[model samples]
Target: MTVAPHPALSANLATPTQAPAQRDDAPIELSTLRLPTPPVPPDTCVIDVAQLFLDANYAGLLSLPIVAADGAPVGMISRYELMRVFLQPYGRELFGRRPISVLMNHAPLVLSVETSIGDAARAIAQHIRSPITDDFVLVENGRYVGTALVLDVLRAVEGRLADRSTELERAYVRLKSSQAQLVQSEKMASLGQMVAGLVHEINTPLGYVRNNVEMTRGVLADASQLIVAQQAALDALLGGDVVADAQARLDEVETLRLRVDPAALDDTAALLDDTLHGVGQIGDLVINLKDFSRLDQAGAQKADLNHLVASALKIANHILRKRGIEVVHQPGELPPVECAPAQINQVLLNLLTNAAQAIEHERGRIVVATRAVEGRAMVLIQDNGKGIAAENQARIFDPFFTTKPVGEGTGMGLAISRQIIEQHGGAIRMTSSVGQGTRFVVVLPLRAVVREAA
Candidate 1:
């Protein structure tokens, strides 16, 4: 039996709208891969369908959609099916005049034009079989729109994946850049606070040194007057001047000598010693500032953790003193730990600062102790302050997590400290009881280890 060809099928042979440019933020739809191949009516003969496949116009297509009278897709007829039929002995004569539906796939993979490329690929995966016979059909509102090749859908999906991978790589790069910036900003903020304290630390010594110099200047002036008077008396005596004149010069010398207290000389010497000590104190502070400001330097070295702790403590002394916090340093003999000194200094300072801030009352005490345990360097910082809450302890190291009031903290100190420690092949842990106190322990390997940037 034969069937009349549908006129609507011929009208759809015109090219469809071109696909839009792909975007990373947008999901690609199946319509972008659609090919407007004309469909065949269900009653069309096998011979006529075979002739259509042979035409160069439809050579690239694997199958043609078989639509019902109302434009609904019923099945698909593939080139492989026709080739099989014609290749068989006496096959063309037996089935050539029959309806193509007799050999068409009654159930094809049908998807809407609005389906995402990923979803379309998944559907094809589930429904596809070995030896890949037919192309999937694209429809709109339950009616046939056009047919698309399985190979085209596969290519589109692959392209989308490649695009997604590229986008992810870019995003990762941006995230790393942002992280670096944040680390540097925190360093600057810490430095600013440290500088304010250091200024006071330096001024205390500078004030005494200035006063000592002034006192010494007064002593030197009196001594010079005595020297001049004694010289004059010697000149009068040696030049055979009158006894009265010589006696007058000698009397002037005696008077000046009496005015210069003998103890003033001794006191001047002591003042000089104190001045030297004050200068040395200033020098040591400058050195600590230099070490603390080495934030831009990268690379690790074997360093005495005790020295780093001391330096951090010195810088933070002003803060602790202002709050009347007592700091106890108990450093034990241990092997040197290889690490980035500047970064470790930053971590120590951050911890000390946090400890100082945690205390809301006078009589705050912070104990910093170091020891070697099992070939690893350990630093324990315990603070007697209002400690972290039980629920908030777990997320203390999470980025941007803070219990402090807004504008008083950046919430990155603990997070960055943890990152720095972990990158150095170390671990940091915390234990606290709400009103009792909090203790942070940092354990580090005593040998150098390759570290990756976070």
Candidate 2:
């Protein structure tokens, strides 16, 4: 029987063209790999179908699609299967006249034109066997489009993987850069807050010190004038000057002395004392700010936890005071623990800030306590405030997760705090109830284990 070529396939029997370059994120269309090979009807004689495979145009094709009268793909006939059938003795005579359907793959791999490259790869990987004997059929809307070599699909998939790997590397670098920026941004924000508070704390003493210095200057001037007048009067008396001139110098001295109150000297001394105290207060604040930041210090060192806590509190005192939040510090005797003091100070300040922010009311109380446990140090911060919701408590440490109104919080404080603690071979945990309160516990090893760069 004479077999007819599929009309649609015969119109486009040219060699396959290379697919156009696709974007990394774009889905690969199966039609890009489709080979417009003519399909044969199932009724075609096996020997006649075999002759079609011998055509130079079809030499590279591993399989030909078999379509039904209505254009639906029914199966595939591979070159391997055809060669296997004809190689045996008397195999040609026995099967040459039989219908090609008898040898066709009943359950061939069929993919849609819309299938993504990754999906297609997965489908082929699952069904493809060793020494691949058959190519897959590409269909659109359940109708035959053309054939696709399994090797082509594999190559497409491999190329896609390579592209994806490159894309992932680029994405990872961007992510790291963004993370670093966010961390620095948070640090700068904290620094700004500390500076504002320190300014306010320093101004109070600075204002008084300025006033006292001015007053002391005036009193000293009056006393100096009185002494000069008295010296003139004494010189006039010793040199036997005219009585009227001596009387005039003496009278001037009395007038200047009267201008300088008897208690003015003592008052000046008191003012100087107060000025020194104010200066000391400013100095302490400067010292505390420096200690809290520790920007000059690097690496790990043995540091007193109490000192760190005090520095953080002093830095955040203005914030707490403005909110009328009372702080109760309970410090226990602790050995100096080896740690990054700057990082620890940051963590402490974050906790203190969080505690203060959590309190929604004016009469809020926060208890900060520290103690040395067996081989470790522990710090506890407890606040009487509206607590975290039960469901949100789990994600409290997740980066960028915040309940604060947008623009008010970066949500990195707790997350960074936890990271710092954990990096020092420590742990941070929280306990909270919706309406009652919240508490955070931090545990640190006496000697931190240094971690290698990731």
Candidate 3:
């Protein structure tokens, strides 16, 4: 009965299961490390230059001490240095003012990646003039390889330890990065769950198309009867069947003694075809929506604006039909946008749906136009509903600021709309009148600027 368990397996069974590690209170080395790269070719943006100026002015990246080119020492870029190059009295005009490259300090100080964080911080303290030092780009061999910021190094080395602690912590971060990926994988799973529900919600209108086909058949039958009776009475009076020239003058159906002739049953067939066609359009919208919400969990890419618009229309059809509204799309088309299609579609969906529902009473009209303007594609969704009140216009885009009844609105539509557009480096604007209607316009550049840190 005394069979011995393997040491490793026995220990595994004997000890309680270990809890998974969380990032809180963890060392900098344990913190997520983005093995830094030189902010150069491929990922760098000219905008980064402007971002440097703006971020430097705001985020205080300007004064963070720079390590020497040889990883020997550190120094800070002063306000005077920044202003001399940045042209600061008009900092607000920087984006339209000039290229950012002219402002960047070349041959700035650098540091070795293996340099202990404790020494790096001390080096920064010894060289820093004012405010604080933030970065220490680590170089290896002869070129810049990765960044080892003051903050990152401080986190890497905390408590009574030596180089071993830093190595352990850095190793932990390297391992932890893989773990963080698993966390992202989990979020993707949640998004998949959202899409499943959306698919079900979309099938609703498709179900109604089948019912509408039947209703159209009935209405066509009634319409045919009215048409046939009129024609038959006219034919008899002209043909002199039970009605001579003198009797043709008879006033009404009863007085004329008219006989009924069956109407062409085929008219009902044509009417049914037309009605069914109208109803099937709603189904196409559902397909487009499914396309927009597709589970492409990766990053941004080119997207079909037309297809995206169609899906949003499908999702909003619930409100559009009730208002007896018609949507008109212009003929102009576009190339795919090099941005996040799903997110952009969400914004467009919100705008189009909002426009369709803005009208509380009577039939309305919605117009959508898309085309290139000023090196960017512009999309406009306009609704002829009761225009927005001047008082509420400013606050309309604020999150959770809806005027809808409880349970019917989340007030997040416009706010979410704004965020989605901005994420794509775009702008959205709205125009409205008290008695007329509301209109939303979105503008996004054709090309995207890839951002990198220098």
Candidate 4:
């Protein structure tokens, strides 16, 4: 996910340097250099630096930079504050060619390094907004500390998530030993839960096996002897000359059948059979669960792409239930692909979720199709949603950027997805237009079987 392009700021991103300063009691005027600067493009505002100020805003450098005591900047200011001035005509003219001293908003909202991000976000919402023209500034004691640009806020939130992907990528490298330990830990936890369920699952079958054995022993010991007696009588009748003997033998066999109690035997067999069938179902469930959560699949392996997709679809079936999103798969019994199955699953999840969210009014449809291309396995996920705008297509993978409303997403999904796919020796490409829809194509190497043959 990428952060939306800010209206006030240019495409360039700037990283401010931290410097030392002496404390001053009287208000110190901020200059243009201390304002929000992008590291991407380093150029002074050529027209009038005043244009950098939000529309009609009184604030100079409309960006409030966090400064060390010596008046060196540690952080920049807020655009929302600059916007307040844009509403007035004088604020617009006042911004023109004016010295930052006369125009800069003196009181910058500041925060400490230890401050929780939640508190920082709240501070920005409450005190630092425009009219007040302050934002949560990073402060260490009485000195300026670090800065959290609005563009970088979400990126900062996922502080721990950085290593998560790095671990997955260079997983076999020497440095990945710690990452392997983490994956091992994950495996152990998953195995523990699986073991518990399996024990409960096996217990039912064991209990019935005990009951079945007891019933089978009783039937063979008691009822079987009676059947033998009836057979003996029938043999004697057949050997005799008298019709009365044959009638008596037939009656004897009927007597044994009547004494056996057929209902009990039927009940025992049914219970044992049902228990066996249930055990089979439980084993199947365990296998699917294990397959879904396996972490070692980080290494690329030759496997069935269609089978993997189908399994992942089954696992994610619950997510699609309430969204009115239908997933259609045009999968053939495809050749194996050299890929990391888990990463592929993660990519599919992101695409599927995005497809579901893209729908506006009525139903939405996503088609996942597979085919062969060159020496690769070609997978396409197509969605009928609001679609991507031309302006935003290139920036879609920038971290912390999101098109969705505030609080709905952190915007790391696609960026991470692309990285993961690329690490597995694959490429992900997308195509979309405003009114139409979006299609994501994932291309991976064909199975080694096919490659070797070539």
Candidates' C-alpha lDDT: 0.90, 0.86, 0.56, 0.58
RMSD of 4: 21.4
> Model 1: per-residue lDDT, tens digit, 336-445?
89999999999999999999999988889999999999989999999999999988998989888988788667889999999999998999999999888999999998
When summed lDDT is taken over every stretch of 10 residues in candidate 1, the lowest stretch is: 1-10
Which structure among the candidates has the greatest TM-score? 1
Q: Name the weakest run of 10 consecutive residues (lDDT summed) in model 4.
A: 38-47
- Give the residue spans of candidate 2 off by over 4 A: 1-8, 15-26, 38-61, 64-75, 82-102, 139-145, 168-190, 293-302, 322-326, 338-340, 357-365, 385-392, 395-412, 433-437, 449-454
**Winner by lDDT between candidate 4 and candidate 1:** 1
- Per-residue CA lDDT of candidate 3, range 1-454, in tens? 1222223223323433232353444433311322332232212223443344354222533332333334322333334555554475655465334433344344454655445445566776775445443354445553444344455545545442665687789999887686445434433433343355455555564565566666565665555554555566677677767655335434444432332223434445665666566556645655665666664722577767766676666666656665688888773577777766766666776677677658776768999888877778888898888888999999998866988776545676677667657766778899999878888999887774412100
Decide which is better by TM-score, 1 or 2. 1
- Per-residue error at 366 for model 1, in Å? 1.8
**Candidate 3 colliding pairs:** 28-155, 67-109, 67-110, 68-109, 68-110
What ranking of all candidate models by TM-score puts the best one first?
1, 2, 3, 4
Ranking by lDDT: 1, 2, 4, 3
Backbone clashes for every candidate come to: 0, 0, 5, 23
Give per-residue CA lDDT, model 4, range 1-454, as digits (tens): 1222232232222344432241332211121113233311112221233344433322333354434334334444345534545556777666534434343445656655555544555565665544543433454454443334533433443542565567667765655565445434433543453355456555666676677777767865657867787777778776884887777777777877777778867776786686677667557656666676776776668888887777656555544544667889999646778777766766676676676677674677788898887878888988888899888999888765689876444466687677667676678899997767899998877753211100
Q: Would you estimate the TM-scores of all the predictions?
A: 0.93, 0.80, 0.42, 0.40
| Candidate 2 per-residue C-alpha lDDT over 297-374 given as tens digits, one digit per residue, 9 for 90 to 100 | 547889899989988988899989999999999999899998888888888988888888889987899999999999
- Return the clash pairs for model 1, or none: none
